[model samples]
Target: MKQKIVIKVNIHCQKCRSKAMEIAAVADGVISVAIEGKEQDQVVVIGDGVDSACLVKRLRKKVGYAYLVTVEEVKPKEEKKEEKKEEKKGEKPTCQPQCHGYPYFVHYETVDEPNPSICSIM
Candidate 1:
């Protein structure tokens, strides 16, 4: 049976909302999702047999966002490192021939103190 789940998520801006949408859209059994209630941001996930716990876990791991419950839970230590890795990818990574089939970039080398790290854009 399908269900409407209103999760108290920390959806701050349009970008965040979009990321949440992306995560929810790909999740199994998720028919639809939307961020509603401007006064109170509510992420509505509509799906059949959606595993709320697992869905929340994937959201934080894959999207780099927190799933706000009664109170914010400390993100698992391992996930914190994963988030940092994703951020580094954004800073220094570019398309390599191997990445043609995927939406990813090749990470070259890192810079030493000061000068901004450079990466060839695709």
Candidate 2:
């Protein structure tokens, strides 16, 4: 079951808020964690089978005083995708690949072998 838990945490600064968010994120079955509320002191955690009480306790111990604002079941939203038309064999597809985050690497260099030898370990 998918659940959304909103915890009101006493976040005084950026560090406290980040710590609270980090704590909630590392919890078991957590899908997403976001700092919310008007004062940016609430931590919103969405996940499957998340322990709300334990999460608040961890925040209280690590960050500051914390309490459960709300715990409720959330329904997943379904998006409608447009169907693509049949393309000619020579034509390129319209869709383009997108990179979400920083690329860990640009390209890998392939080392050409000058000679091949049988393994002697066997």
Candidate 3:
């Protein structure tokens, strides 16, 4: 048996809360989930031998959140989420393209533009 850990996460509503709970429950040794705060983002999970880092990552990915941290390290989920939301306001995604859009090239320079000389060859 492993010690129960408290993790603070950012969810959205009841649907999100339920979805998060369902995801966590599917983990290897998750026991139960209890979410605090009004925003439905604060969650506490009791489990044994569960990986905190992975859990946080999955929760963030599933809930469409940017910041996920331990409830102990950062108390009051509202403040942390607000800070994250504020931080996100100024930082836009980098101008790089993802592999999903274009399989041939990893970036726009190689994929988005066509070669002028190569046009004759085609």
Candidate 1 wrongly placed segments (more than 4 Å):
68-122
Question: Candidate 2, residues 1-122: lDDT per residue as tens digits?
Answer: 89999999998998898888888887877889998789998899999988888888888889889999999999867734654334568854433222234568778799978896778996
TM-score per candidate, in order? Answer: 0.49, 0.63, 0.49
lDDT of 1 by residue, 1-122 (tens): 65666666676777877877787776666667877776445677877766667667766775565564431222334455445423344543432222124567788997687876676783
Residue pairs whose backbone atoms clash in candidate 1? none
User: In model 3, where do residues sit more than 4 Å from their true spots?
Assistant: 66-68, 71-122
Q: Note the Cα lDDT for every prediction shown.
A: 0.63, 0.83, 0.61
**Which portions of model 2 show Cα errors greater than 4 Å?**
79-122
TM-score of 1: 0.49
Query: Candidate 3: TM-score?
Result: 0.49
The clash count for each model shown is 0, 0, 1
Among all windows of ten consecutive residues in candidate 2, which has the lowest summed lDDT?
92-101
What local lDDT score does residue 10 receive in model 2, on the 0 to 100 scale?
92
